[model samples]
Target: MQQTFFDLEVALASLPRILEGLWLNIQVLVAASIGVLLFALVLATLRALRGPA
Candidate 1:
């Protein structure tokens, strides 16, 4: 039980670093998703307008 408490303490100390990395990854993923969606929307619009021309 004593060793478990020590391990828990170590894990808690490292939690912030782990969460920081995860937050960074999440931000990157969100940005990439938005970029892809915008590109896709533009392509779709262009494709729709192609038949009339």
Candidate 2:
């Protein structure tokens, strides 16, 4: 059966306003992952250098 706009609105309204919040969270996580990967590369380079000269 076909649904109506009111049905859609009601379904959406039933959930928390976390859809936008989740989008932001996913964006932050992706950025953090990139940063962590870059930082890990830097750390590996430092480790290759052995003790401080």
Candidate 3:
């Protein structure tokens, strides 16, 4: 019973670290997505300006 309680406590304490890692992963993914979107937009704009060669 005592070991179970200790295990539960450790699991709860680790939750925040896990959440923080997940948040960081999400942030990095969002940043990469934004960068790709911007890059594509710029490429499209340049293509439009070139105008049907």
Residue 39 lDDT in candidate 2:
100
Q: Model 1 — which ten-residue stretch has the worst lDDT?
A: 1-10
Candidates sorted by TM-score, descending order?
A: 1, 3, 2
lDDT of 2 by residue, 1-53 (tens): 77666696777885566687888899999999999999999999998986967
TM-score of each: 0.74, 0.60, 0.69
- Total backbone clashes of model 3? 0
Q: Candidate 3 local accuracy as lDDT?
A: 0.91
Candidate 3: C-alpha RMSD after superposition:
3.6
User: Model 1, range 1-53, lDDT digits (tens) per residue?
Assistant: 45755587889999999999999999999999999999999999998884744
**Which regions in candidate 2 have their CA more than 4 angstroms from the true location?**
1-11, 14-16, 50-53
True-vs-predicted CA distance for residue 45, candidate 3, Å: 0.9
Instruction: Give stretches of model 3 more than 4 Å off.
Output: 1-7, 51-53
Output the number of the TM-score-best candidate: 1
Report the poorest 10 consecutive residues by lDDT, candidate 2: 9-18
